[model samples]
Target: MTLPIEPTAAQQAAARVRDAVHSATVGLIEREQLAELIVLAAVAQEHLLILGPPGTAKSAVVRRVASALGGRYFEYLLGRFTEPSELFGPVDLRRLREGVVETDVSGMLPEAEVAFLDEVFLGSTAILNTLLGVLNERRFRRGHTQIECPLRVCVGAANALPDDESLAAFADRFLLHLFVEPVPDHQLEALLEGGWQSERAPLAHRTELSDIDELSRRVPLVDLTHARGLLADAIRKLRGAGLSLSDRRIVKVQRLIAAATVLAGRDTATDADLWPLFYVMPTREAQASAQDVLRDSMSAAANPTLRAAVEHAVLQPVSRAARLVEAARSCLQAGADAPGTATIAEALLREIDANFDAKSLPPELAAERARLIERVATPT
Candidate 1:
């Protein structure tokens, strides 16, 4: 397919960039799951919760990642013995005399852009409460002032998912849940051979916040029409399978796709970028739920009849809209000599977009939807 603009070196460099990032982070874990963890952490622009026993290289991996991406780093261990003041900051004494609590935002959660909170569930109420706002709203309020922490990602290291009710809300805020284990027996020799620690300098991959902001800017512009159906179908199937994840995850997955596309310097998302799900899939029990969801989806469904119904219900309108866009481009490029130039192009685009709106499938793909309706209804 021809594009209006030639694919530049940035576009050509996607795989190289991805591979470098992948290789840089791979040795820290025993399996590819950790790689997926890093990808999700990057794309979702969300924190990751690593659940495993100690000595799994959780901090090492996160530290290597921060070094590679070049984001600010803060690491702290949370335990019954942990202190809130250590993780956040010390309150200002002079301000306290003036009936004000002034705290310098310079520690683990506040000053760092990408953070590593070890033993996250063991924190006291103060830290957990502060974390709730940091993870959810991306802001930390102290005294009468709110601190907007420029967090690219936060990595929480836990021995396992917390069972306590008080911590569950904070735990749930982590969008990606990954199980990290010690290196395999075979890989241990290599681990020993390579030395016990990762050689990655924290600043090596430290991407400027502006670069991330630019990636955010580019992602929403990416067209994901082709993959949208598959993603939606996956979500519906996961729901049907009784996965315990919340609806908020659907939004997170969408954002992950967009970010992945941007990092690839692409204008649209596709199945190639779907691998990031390995990180974001909910629980160990739900890995099957995720696999089941994608098994048929990424493979192309066996139910051709149902697939056709889906295509007719979803793909046809997008196809028409794409054609309309192509036609509009041609008309506009004809230098005004083309017949009905502006009006014709506008009318076609408007109709296609109008049809695009009218073309969404029914939520319940019941018997009625299985049989194509004469006209497609617009997506709300």
Candidate 2:
């Protein structure tokens, strides 16, 4: 049987790409949220730093992401002794025979479309130092020549934070940092008994690299007025929790806004799309810091849930009338005659009056209901 194709937003190319990624993978904990963040980072063409203890399936997820896109895969386990040669291709002895300064063979760093650096912070000063150039500049200098890489995204897993001062630069290069801890005690027994291990899966559908590039170009155009206020609240909460806000990271946070915008396929980003920024922050302190922010933004007072009676009897008609007017305008755009302006305006006003009358209740009850409706209508 053929799988049904899902309806997608007009500009959200990443949504389709994400579906392809979803079809190829299995066994990611909280797969829905993970998939969304993965697609957002891919859409933004930015790297992520996966922080977890061993066996958290970080590498497996990376493999799945690459499989979905049919990109070149390069994996490395960095250690204290790992040299720059392990990443950049070795010098060609044959090139020396011709007195050539550069070797034509490409290194893993240069040729990789998607790279997974496991135990990333374990590398020597040279390797960690070199990654700074590769990630930020997208180039690796070999002798007198520089090689440009066609890197789509890089996913690096860290067992623990590194102590080396130079490695800090490499750590900062990843725009998104997601920490994956083991499941809670309630889920641990099931996970162990479930016989899950990271394994390769054949691709079910593949995404074109061009689709990813197109998503990057389109994501920035999404507007985010409502989301910006909530995001500002969230960031304020983080600051209140005593997390240091770096000036450089403020710019990075804005970049993820573009990612959120593209994911929703809107010309403007909304509160619904800003949900993932809660997960993309760089530090553990920042992640722990957003709890108050979420509590305040998503609370009953801020975003109350409306009663079914009110929603159906009052809100529905008003919403329907607004949509009907929009549809009439769209019909006019299509060169089809619909209702006249005066008629449509009167119908809308009538609907509004009916809605307000139906929705009216005791003053206190009405206030509570409005609060509840506000919570439900507030974006994610």
Candidate 3:
């Protein structure tokens, strides 16, 4: 567990996360947001809850991340009848014979570095109560079966959030919530292509578990003196707009902000890193409304490793502009004469113009706009 020097550690950790996420997303079309957040949660030592329908590839995304990052992966589909032992493992008969109870955690959720639990809310009360300790304290405690869990991130996926009031506390333990939907019709052709590629190709990179551990250790040491005021102001605006913010969430969100800074290759967090505060809200509806409320404080929010995540969090011109520039650049680089290049460049130009005012466009965005315009006007 040798930690690198200050800024160098940030740079190395950022590169590791970026490469792993990039590899995980290679054949998965439009799922980069999920991949990026998976790495973020691992680095921050928190949990993620994904709200998407049955066929949305939630488990696939988590599995890809685990594969690219080279860790032990465990996945299960939970049901009302799923026994605690089904996930935790069976009790040791030898220990039971001695009038002691303990779980044999070999190849179980407690031993997994990365895990996914589908239909998480359907788990019985006994299961959810036990699962909470793993999420909150990173420990497994049941009778005499106490063990430290090495789990980096536990992703819980449900088709929809539960309507039961009693489940709310358990669900809230998953601090970050992401809502996903079926791919829209326009991307169906790309979806077909990506699906075929995914079946044929393996992930492109491998990262060590120590990379994640080093980043987690760095999260607490990140300089937040300047970013704190920005975050506080954003919270005030969200509250004024009628979004509830519990004191616990307000305190814990600092970890997410610091993790973002480290993953963005910076030692000190700035106003740009405050965008993760949007995720502290407990529900999808609250998150959607938060985008508009916190727009001013987050105009500078951008992350090269997490561009897709930034797009999902903030839909402002600057954020939208980043994605447009990436699209335009990719189209330009694939030989401006490549098939469908003009069509892609045309779409990017139109999107750029629609999202940004030419008279007041940010300089970097304005340059990308010019590049797109030139590519559209002349095919080669």
- RMSD of each candidate relative to the true structure: 17.6, 14.4, 4.4
Off by over 4 Å in 1: 1-23, 26-36, 196-209, 300-380
lDDT of 3 at 171: 79
Instruction: Compose the digit string of candidate 2's lDDT tens values, residues 181-278.
Output: 77554344334432242243345567776777777777666566767787777667767776555667655676677665665455565554444455
What value does the lDDT take at residue 226 in candidate 1? 73
Which clashing pairs does model 3 show? none
> Tens digits of per-residue lDDT for model 3 on 60-118?
88888888877888999998899999999999999999999889899999898999999
Lowest-sum lDDT 10-residue window in model 3: 338-347
Q: Where in model 2 is the C-alpha error above 4 Å?
A: 1-12, 103-107, 185-201, 224-233, 297-380
lDDT value, candidate 2, whole model: 0.58
Sort the candidates on lDDT, descending order: 3, 2, 1
RMSD of 2: 14.4
